[model samples]
Target: MNTADFIKARAAALGFDVCRFASASEPWSAGERLAHFVEAGRHGDMGWMETTLERRAHPTSMWAEAKTAVVLGLNYGPGHDPLPEMGDASAGYISVYARGDDYHEVIKGRLKTLAGQIAARTGEDVKVFVDTAPLMEKPLAQRAGVGWQGKHTNLLSRTRGNWLFLGVILTAAELEPDAPESEHCGACTACLDVCPTQAFPAPFQLDARRCLSYLTIEFAGPWPVEFRKATGSRIYGCDDCLAICPWNKFAVASHESRVQAREGLVSPRLADLAALDDAAFRALFSKSPVKRIGRDRFVRNVLYAIGNSGDADLIEAARALLDDPAPVVRGGAVWALSRLMDDEAFAALRSERAGGEADASVRVEWAADQA
Candidate 1:
């Protein structure tokens, strides 16, 4: 086999589900969409999107000598439907991918290994990037024939379906690029219709500010009152759109042991999660992706779900957090308590704690709940 074929074979041997190549200079039309997403302020608090647009718009702008891009996808399909967990209000629904090890580390290590093997064989310059960089991975993955960016704006394949962790390798060596796949999403809007928060404003366009994943994971402070009910039990990233994709019929559960769901992570009890102290949180999610959000924010998310749980049993869990030092956590607790108790009861509690509620943001949360 030639160098490109050899690299693909090595990638396969390394257990990557899909591997393909694309010219680094491929006319990435999605750049225009990204520009628009940022310009429209749809990215919300994600200021990084604005800062990186220039480089993300063009691969050549990122690495002038990049002659080829090797895109690889790691399948993280769930063992069962992720939707049911959303209805199980007593439990928190973590995005399937984050139930195990952090993909950034797992996938990046594999990417480096693949790049090293290629470097040894071809002796050409190479650089690898996971999601953190200002890289437009989905469009590049489509350009490489690994998958098409489904209406969910995530890479999905006929074989791999909607579950994929995309990583890219940029190389100076010129390689034969794969033919781009045409969109097969024909007459389907299941992904768009499934959004609980109506994140997708239009076909193939997502407003990140309205995305449950962004709200739960990225947007800090008190959970937005308007979206709290819609966020449901999703404490981390969401999978509503991806799980609803009809294309998922062809997908199989992920086999990567490192990426497989870790014990006690799937649909964990909201009460237990709400009780996690910082040390317990760290221990529970030591190498897991959930730890990235930190103890306060993760608890903040759990409190939102607790508020909506209506279990009433978790009311004490939410009540205890109302005095927590973290303003965001206190704010989230206020929202949870408001949901669990009536306005009269919440007002009484607010009156008692009014003096200690020193944080302005938490005060805002209190005022909103009272309103």
Candidate 2:
């Protein structure tokens, strides 16, 4: 068997759903598109994208000797559309990928094991990478025939749909590259149309500043007034575009148990999540991706959800956060209370509390305009 065939076999044994090869040295336009995205300031507050622009342009830009890219994908599909979860305004809607254990933790060890086997068999230097690295896995995945980048700017596969978690193994060995996947998204606007924030600028482009996923995850501080209400009950990442894809019809639930939804994460109550202290937050998301945002930001997101919930029972939960040490959390509380409380009652509470707020931004949240 050829080297590519051997690697695919080993990757399957290691539990990867799809394995394909691509020329790491080949020139691709993904870099130019990313540069444009950053240049247009569409990357939002993610300064790391600008900082690593040079190294992230191509696989060879980071490792000059990387001749081949062994792209592997793991299916993490939820078996059904998670969009329906948003209907439960009292519960927080976490992105499906983050409902389980962190994908990095789940996929990294398997990637390393596969890389080691390839190294042993081919006598080649290999480096394994998950999404944490500078390597742009999606473009490489497309070049390797694993999937195509859909209009939503996410990798989509005919068989796996929008639910694949990707990892890459860059090696010095020269393997024949697989046929690249082409654009299968024809006249489909479901992903573009479904965004609550209207994050898409045009087809195949995203303005991250307006994306709820970015606002809930990568962004810190109290979100813009406009997005706070639009956030609905999404306390973490938003999955509207991913869940709305037509290709998902062929996708099945993930076979990997570790990637399945956890006991309380699927559609957790907003009140329960809003009550999480720092210690409790750490414990609840011990091995999950949600822990990275830290307790304050996560609670801030929960507060936004609470504001949009229209559930008056959660008023006490928001009221309790008024004195939170984190300015952002306190700010979020103010917004939540404004929505849940009557005008006169909210005015009385604001008059009592707004003067004492030390943070400038939190004080703004207490202003009449916010209510």
How many residue pairs clash per model?
0, 0
Which runs of model 2 end up more than 4 angstroms from their true locations?
none
What would the TM-score be for candidate 1 when compared with the true structure?
0.97
Model 2 steric clash pairs: none
Q: In terms of TM-score, how similar is model 2 to the real structure?
A: 0.99
Candidate 1, 211: how far from true, in Å?
0.3
lDDT of 2 by residue, 89-122 (tens): 9999999999889999999999999999999989
Model 1, range 328-368, lDDT digits (tens) per residue?
Answer: 88888888888888778888988887767677888888778
Q: What's the TM-score of every candidate structure?
A: 0.97, 0.99
Backbone clash pairs for candidate 1 read: none
How many residue pairs of model 2 clash at the backbone?
0
Best by TM-score: 2
